[model samples]
Target: MTQDPVSIEPLCLDEGHALGEFYPLKQQAQAEDFPADPAACRKDFLGQILHPRPGNSVLAWGARMGGRPVGLCAVGVPEAGRRWTADVVHFVVHPDVRRTGIGSRLLATATGHLAGLGVQKMTAFTSGPADGAGAGDAFAEATGAARILRYQRLSLRIGPTRLATDGDTGAGCELLHWRDDVPAEYRAAFAAMSSRLAAEEAARSGSDQVPEDFDEDKVQELYAVLRAWGYRTYLTAVRHRETGLLVGYSALGMADSHQRHASQWDTIVLPSHRGRGLGVVLKRANLSWTVEHEPELATVTTWNAIGNPAMLHVNESFGFRLDQSGARREWTL
Candidate 1:
């Protein structure tokens, strides 16, 4: 018996709506533990596809059956740096169509598209244990990809004293926190710290990640997009009082309407200021701020590299438990 051949095609702004529609169906079929709101997910997909920020390009491919999308594979390439690498954002296939070779076709086509752009390396992340019988693990194994790094997604239940801790001040430094926007006075220093951390992270991970292109204008632009997408950002930082430099930083991001979950993003302390317990202080401040402003916020999720014990220790103190785990897989061509 012969089955219909899967048709994989590139998607652009014209098929953006189709990609949005396929996402919810795919999530519902695959991710049973954490179901996504179709409307919200669709809205976010459309927003990113139709009006992406500058210096970012998307390459998306859809698997079609009977003229309807049944699978999706998408990746993004930064315009400014790391032109040789692509970030695989989503790779999903409808449940009913599993083990039917559709995913392989979609992946092949997506990779072909990336190859046309001269991309030399590809990176992907999925949510499951490496040894587990998860779809992501299966896909990685079948594709000859190597799991380079392991990470854990931890969730902290927000309650009285959930994220509160005593303030530990460093010599000649003070802490500052803000919501929604980075203050003008500290934007430059903030960008510098963030850029260094990004570059260092790439080096440690053995990826060709170029330095982060962060500036005051870039920070402002990010805040604008967050506002447009209905997200509130809380930022905490420690600055040297004498030098007026940002030595440590952390952030919490919560959706405006979805008050149940917040994401903890980008915590870093400068190498020169590493021993001051600044990581814990910055994280605590941001978590406290999120709880105060978003009263309905129940759980905050943060991702940590398995090798980073310092940050992990701080998160443990805040009572964050492992909610999900995954391995970062990369392939070089």
Candidate 2:
């Protein structure tokens, strides 16, 4: 006997067990070699929903088969603004119902909810599954989202040599590491570079929803908070050598420094500063600094957009390979 298809609708957060059942699917979709312990996935999904932040959100929607959740999708809006965008964050369907259009309906409906709230753009990440790569690629095609960024991951084995290349100096640019004490002359230059880097990534300095007094002081405060929380990997690169003008920078990070995997994030080189090979120079400089200062480090990871061949070339020279690839998709109102 054939069973009828299930219907879709938003499930209130208060709708308990039915919503909780979706964690397994989220885990399988999210991680490779995911923990078998039920508590791991359960804690993660709920923890984010409960994280205290002004615009944090979690919306779960699904359809049931035989009174059980046979398909599901989730969206999270951790922040929002006019010229800003929200992330699809998480979306998945039960394996049994995949390829049945159930996931599409769930995503379409959730995107509608975001649009109704005045969202202008949306994003979701895609890293190839442990087994295959089609899931995120196919979904983005069906939706209206265009891929805006690309990331590639790489690995480093022991005794590997560092990547070096010819540096460009015709642009009056060179890379320098920020010292324990920032030079007085470079404060304004550092600020300008930070502003450009964030702008290039479409991150606004602040939104109207945030207070007017929010400034760089607040930023330093947040960094201080991160420092207190043990998330600190203090690193900043500047072009102070070339007439004291700053052109490129990279922020070093680590999930758990005690672990083998450290990471590089928030890397940027000015548009006019591009093609000079300053990126590679800066990275090598940072790498040398890290190896000398922190000998315990084993491997470093970085992501490059699948389409960003330029940065990929620079990173590849240093042995960075695909650690993760997230497919980003969206729907416009």
Quote each prediction's TM-score.
0.88, 0.62
Look at candidate 1 and give me any clashing residue pairs: none
Instruction: State the displacement of the C-alpha of residue 31, model 1, in Å, after optimal TM-score superposition.
Output: 3.8
Which prediction has the highest lDDT against the true structure?
Answer: 1
The residue ranges of model 2 lying beyond 4 angstroms of the native Cα positions read 1-25, 31-84, 94-97, 100-102, 129-132, 148-160, 163-191, 198-234, 239-245, 256-258, 271-277, 288-298, 306-309, 322-327
How far out, in Å, is residue 177 in model 1?
2.2
Superposition TM-score, candidate 1 onto the true structure = 0.88
What is the per-residue lDDT of model 1 for residues 1-333, given as tens digits with 9 covering 90 to 100? 665667887776566556676766555654553453212344444555554554567777878887767788778777744568777766878777788888888777877777777887777887764335467767887888777777888878778765556377656888888989898888888888878877766665755556566888887777777666567789989888898888889988876546678889999999988876788888887787777788877778888888788888989977888877777788775
Q: Please give, for residues 227-256, the per-residue lDDT of candidate 2 as tens digits.
A: 433443635565745466677776665432
Deviation in angstroms for 318 in model 1?
A: 1.6
